[model samples]
Target: MKLTSTASRKLAALSLDEIKEAQQEASRQFEEFKARGLSLNMARGKPCVEQLDLALGVLEALHARSEFANSNGDDCRNYGVWNGLPEMRAIFGELLGIPDDLIILGNNSSLQMMFDCISQGYTHGYSGCEPWCRQGDVKFLCPAPGYDRHFAVTEYFGIQMIPVPMLKTGPDMDLIERLVQDETVKGCWCVPKYSNPTGVTFSDETVRRFARLKPAAKDFRIMWDNAYCVHDLTDEPDQLLNIYEECLKHGTEDQVLIFASTSKISFPGAGVAALAASKRNIDDLKLRTTVQTIGSDKLNQLRHVLFLHDADGVRSLMKGHRRILEPKFHIVLDALEQELGGLGIARWSHPHGGYFVNLDVMNGCARQVVALCKEAGVVLTDAGATFPYGADPNDSNIRIAPSFPPEEELREAMELLCIAVRLAATEKLLYERAE
Candidate 1:
């Protein structure tokens, strides 16, 4: 039968013979894919080669003839600017919508800075508060289908993770509000703009609610990891509510620590990362962070500032990125639509901008689908990697990172993925029918 996109028909709606035929066709395609011995990967959200080439000039931005002093004449080659170069902070300050005084630059990984925040809370706590480790049974709110690294950090710290439902607007605020009422719920991880995997930015109401949350712990923090703040796939992308600004309005500015990086914007390994928070939080972070190192790589910060120039420069660079990325994303979306659009067995996110496309297959079928893809020589991010402890209770959500591969390789991998989704879904329906 010819497929139509007008409406979806569930696999359960098909007769046994029809389901068997569909499964056979999908199995045949899977075997053909396997025979090709394709070694394609869509597992990590890495920038493609073209994207990496865009920042080659960042290396040239600084040279032997260039002065190594920051705007304040502080020698970037030497140690001392424990926070960061003044000009670099100014650039991110404007971009992140926080004041210059509130931003603190770190090494390439914001994930490292996040880990430090949790470590400090565990050992020293935030600003005179008792250490979290000393406290009994600490908990954190984890919005599922989130950045797996975020979940991994919380898990490594031995913090109990509470799963919260992520809605199209954002995580369920009603549930988050209720969970944070307990003092043990010390913090929550947030990717406010073009969230990892799901690519759903928080709504204005959701950001405001997050800011106004009356958490029982004074030291409670909202780890706002806005990694994709400017990674817009379209000219007019989703508008993210400024959580730091909203936090200030609610008199809870210290409650959220905002993070951003130039990883995808430029070189991932050599990019600069920054954290923004209230003065109190900044000072507290400085006190703990200073002992760890004399300072971050100010020369690298200078390289970025000199290259990116300012916020508009960052935006311009991202426009180039969108040019390279947008088409690749469309390839995946189009392949999914053509192959599985009218099959009620699968659905996926059509994000305006982000590094990933979140795909949700029929319940109890994601693992099987991923295994099938693997057997066909196409690797995917494991089915449940989006949730805390790598467990998606429904076992349905799969994070598709389409940024790493070339367009043609990506299209091939995605087509194989759709076939696997169909085969696994059909097998599931048939199994249920037999039962």
Candidate 2:
């Protein structure tokens, strides 16, 4: 049978002979792909060279000697402004919907800030609480198919991670509400807007529920990594309810720590990062920073302030990113639809924004699929990297980072990936049948 005609049928409905034939075809295509010597990567959610080029003007935003000084007349070349420049804080404050006083600008990495937050809690503890290390069996809630780096940070500190299922609206709130009743559950990791891998934006109700949460741990905090707050692909971009705003209404603002960065907006390595929290939390964190370092790179912060100017400038630049990235996402989604839509072996996200396409292949077949893709010269994010401790119990979810590869390479990579998915699915089905 022609694969195109059978493509719409579920694999379970196929006869044994048909399954074998499909497997043979996939193997043939896989070998052909290997012979082509293709070296394409869809591993990390890194911006492409074209996206990077969009920020070329930022490098020259501080070309003159006078430009080194911030709006306050403070020369950015020297240290002293630990809380970052006032104007720089204003830019992030507008973007994040938080007051400038509540925002603490950091280095280029929000991940580093997140780690430091956890580290501080681990080593020194939050106010009125014992250090996390002293608390017997400290735990954290990790929404599954979540950001790997978030899990990595928690894991590095020996924090027990509890995998909460991610729902269409957001993480399983019911489970989180129940889990947080345990005082040992110190915090949770969240990517509320266009969340990593899955691209599931939390609903307004979800945000409200988060704000109203009465966790047993007074020190329970939400690591709100709003990494894709401004990254939109469609004219109708996803709107994430301002968690901080919601928290304030419920008087739970101190429980949420918000993080965002210009890593994707500008240069990834040379961008500015910031954290927003309640005044109490901010003051506590500021005190820690005094001992940590004199200050972050204010010069880079000034460049970002001059370049991005404000929230509107950030939006304009993201539109350019969408233009380049939107097509790439289409390439991956369209291929998956065309090749594996009704195959009953794979399903993936159609993200409006964010840098990854979350794909779930047949259970017990994801690792095999990734391995097959690698052998055929296409690299994908590790199959289990989406979960806590790098373990996906179902072993089905895969993160496809389409931003880094060129369109043609991405197209080729997706084609190979589809074939691998089919081959692995068929092999698993055949083995199960024989058993």
Q: What TM-score goes with each of the models? A: 0.98, 0.98
Q: Which stretches of candidate 1 lie over 4 Å from their true place?
A: 1-8
How close to the true structure is residue 330 of candidate 2, measured as C-alpha lDDT?
A: 96
C-alpha local distance difference test of each model: 0.90, 0.90
Model 1 — TM-score against the truth?
Answer: 0.98
Per-residue alpha-carbon lDDT of candidate 2 for residues 45-162, written as tens digits (9 for 90 to 100): 9999999999998889888656577778888999888989888789789888989999999998999999999998998888669999999899999998999999999999999999
Task: Give the alpha carbon lDDT tens digit for every residue of 405-430 in model 1.
Answer: 99999999998998898889878888
Best model number under lDDT: 2
Considering only N, C-alpha and C atoms within 3 Å, which residue pairs clash in candidate 1? none
Query: Under the 3 Å rule for N, CA and C atoms, how many clashes does model 2 have?
Result: 0
TM-score of model 2 (CA atoms): 0.98
Q: Which stretches of candidate 2 lie over 4 Å from their true place?
A: none
